[model samples]
Target: MPPVERRDPEPIEAYLFDLDGVLRVWDGADLAAVEARAGLPPGRLGEIAHDLDRYGPALLGEVTDNDWRASVVGALVADGLKPDVAVDVVLDWSANLGRVDPEVTEVVAGIRAAGGQVALVVNSTDRLELDLVVLGLDLAVDTVVSSARTGIALPDAAMYEIAAGILAVPAPRCAYVGPHAELVAGAERIGMTGHLFDGVSGLRAIVETLSAR
Candidate 1:
């Protein structure tokens, strides 16, 4: 692995990661597929994904699968598609999606090689087992906390607490890497080091810097 830039050590002991935009790019492709299948114009998925009312609680684990399905169906219906067809199309789009970033995998490996515990905290409607299998990511991390299982998602302090509890580490010693500023901020609020990961190199640098602290 390439050497990550170093920084003075802080107090971080474990690492928490967000799956979608942070660790992979398949999420965008899935959204595109959903919009295309629903015959909607571009930007629909982006709008929904960024809509705090829609995605916030979903990321925090406050939303249920049924709620997600209903919301998706409603969005497609508003876009002039049939509800059942929308549901099916969304399911298909998500089911076919998988991770595409090898650098992320390498970073996870590097974290493990450094003797850091790694965990996944993601906003997912489907069971993580299917997604992990499709992406071949099951063995890459120490634990996977999906909103589907945790009943809470990012930006919610409870979710971070749950992740810390599961990792057997204190919140202050854990680090969270995510693409969303709000989510990273939330982790920071809970005493976890927050790193906004734009790519593998950036994340590797953050990890190395933290490790050295």
Candidate 2:
């Protein structure tokens, strides 16, 4: 990723970041076992995981956690699978919350130690915090702006605005960097310095761009 040019106002007061690709920085848990339990054809489990129509409500906090799990389990059972097998599949699916590169955590921790206020703004389900813990990442941020908790997803101006408010920082003084180009663009539209990270390596590029030279 090319270095982001610093623009307007002053050094950023807070940095709003994405989690999955940005912080996790790796292909997390393998879901092959979860698929096996559900007796799904290869790749079917991944498809269901990304089925927004099935998961959007859960991600938006419109459904309870158990209710959300039951939806997927129910679907599998209806697909000719036994009820016991369906529940087992969903239970196995929960094991792969995610994994984080400790190296990445150090980078964020370093930024925090240098006094950059940070907050995680991720589009995820209620398992976000659980995943964070499972990944062993000790995120030293002011607060997490979770779509599941806030009922607002990323790329929405309101999400970042609320995050800034929670961080007690001005909108323009906050910098947002994420993996999705659209989400970064969304942040840019509202005057926050927004950057798209290429991948794990791109993370350091981001830190350099934000550093005092």
Off by over 4 Å in 2: 1-9, 25-29
> lDDT of all predictions, in order shown?
0.78, 0.78
Candidate 1, residue 9: CA error in Å?
A: 5.4
lDDT of 1 by residue, 25-62 (tens): 75566667667876777777567545778765655557
lDDT of 2 by residue, 1-213 (tens): 999998554577788888887777544236765675556887776666557888898889888666777888777777777989877887877655566666667777877888888899988888778777666653457788889999988788999999999999988878897888899999999988887877556777867776753
Which residue pairs in model 2 clash with each other?
none
Worst 10 residues of 1 by lDDT: 57-66
- The 10 consecutive residues of candidate 2 with the worst lDDT sum are 25-34
